[model samples]
Target: MSVNSQITRTRIMECASKEFMEYGYQSANMRRIAQAANVTTGAMYNHFSNKAVLFDALVQAPAEEMLDRFRGIHAQFKADLPKLTFVHMKETAYLGTDWMLEYIYAHFEAFRLIFCRSEGTRWVSYLEELIAVEERAYCDAFGKRGRRVEDMFLHIIAASGFQYLVECVSHDLSYEKAVAVLDSAKRFSMAGWQELFKL
Candidate 1:
């Protein structure tokens, strides 16, 4: 793309992001996005094929980046589990959450769009996917002991963590406030996990 085309695409993306975040994927208006970007609808189509494509352009980068990070964190968590202590877990959780909060902050609009306004996108079920992965990993690691806890309980906790993140971003919490909230939630979750798994 030339300099002018690049600028136009960026403008279109920014405007489309706000549109998607405000009206959700299902309700977002393509013409409004074009209008906001100061481009013709026909011109916008030259960049993005359609509304879904535009939504993908708006969110795919940040969503994929977060997925990679979440996967890495889960892998690391499992790798370190054999010798995990409550103290170590707490420390790692704090640092991990702090890092995650900062990442989310950097992509706040993208996250808000996916987490709160992606009603018609593939990302709408993202939290469920994350929870299922975590729950399966826990069960694999702990065997019959982990199975003792109901699947619903496992799902609830996993879902809660994702929801907590959405809450932090949706409310626009500051870094310190977000970290503090994460720490408090981590402590509470740690206590529950310890009681459940005897970790």
Candidate 2:
């Protein structure tokens, strides 16, 4: 793309971000976004096929990155499951929480859109997707250890664990405050997991 074209695309994305943040995906106006970007509707369409595409462009990368990071954390834990102890699990959980907090803060706007302003988009299911990933990880880990856990129970645990993380994002907690809250939550959750898993 030419410099001017690239600049216009960036401008459209910025304006679209503000529009989505303000009105949410269901109510955001494409024409208004175009106007805000100082581009014609046709030009905006040329850059982004539609409102959903535009919204995805803004958040897809960060969303995928977060999930990938979570998967990586679980993958590492699973790899070392044979030797993993309660203390190691607790320490890893804390480290993961800290990494997640730092990532969310760095991409606060993208996450805010996902958590708060993405009702009409597929991003609305992002939390559920995260929970599913957690659920799968737990199932795999327990199965590998020949430990049987009920699916419903695993779902509840996974949902609650991720919901605690989402609370930090939804409430817009400061980094320090979020860290403190998640630390306490992690301690509680690790104790529960340890008891349940007999680790």
Candidate 3:
């Protein structure tokens, strides 16, 4: 870890993230990042081979951090199922999201980088391992309760109100306000699913 390398990498990413957020991916300029970072274009290239590679790193850094946290939960939950309910649909999980937003909400550059279609497949592939764990839960619960709809449980979890609840709460909405909605969101979905299999 060369100090020069560290400083250069940080500077480029800081500037580049702002560029992407302001102009979006297609319009982000390497020259702008170099200028903003106070580094020569050659210096920017020294750390990242290309814009695509830099974007990939930007997406992966937060992703890897989240994966590490999720993996930690997976390990703990494997040992104790209570932990799943503990984390599921809870604001406490956003400890990481809060930390991430510190860097990410700068312009949502990082968020857009990972969430836009360009990075979805990579994200799915990375989370497939975690998705597998939830899938197993679906299978187990379905088997125990005779529920047959296992195909999209993970998808529902991803699309459901939980995410909305979090985003809203992050915006300074009271937990009472958010949870008032989130509980309905959770119960309605949970009830529908439970009814689907009579859980």
* lDDT, model 1: 0.81
**Candidate 3 error regions (>4 Å):** 1-5, 71-112, 116-133, 150-184
- Per-residue lDDT over 1-199 for candidate 2, one digit per residue giving the tens place of the 0 to 100 score: 9999999999999999899988989999999999999999999999999999999999999999999988888888888877876576667768877888899889988998998999988999998988887788788778866889999999998898878767888788998888889888988988887787788
Tens digits of per-residue lDDT for model 3, 61-120: 766766576656545544554334433523433443343334444434444555442432
What lDDT score belongs to each candidate, Candidate 1 first? 0.81, 0.87, 0.58
Task: Report the Cα lDDT for candidate 3.
Answer: 0.58
Clashing residue pairs, backbone N/CA/C < 3 A, model 1: none
TM-score of candidate 2 against the unseen true structure: 0.89
| lDDT by residue for model 1 (139-176), tens | 64555233466778777877887778889878878877
RMSD of each: 2.1, 1.9, 5.7
TM per candidate = 0.89, 0.89, 0.60
* TM-score ranking from best candidate downward: 2, 1, 3
Native-to-model Cα distance after best TM-score fit, residue 95 in candidate 2, in Å: 1.6
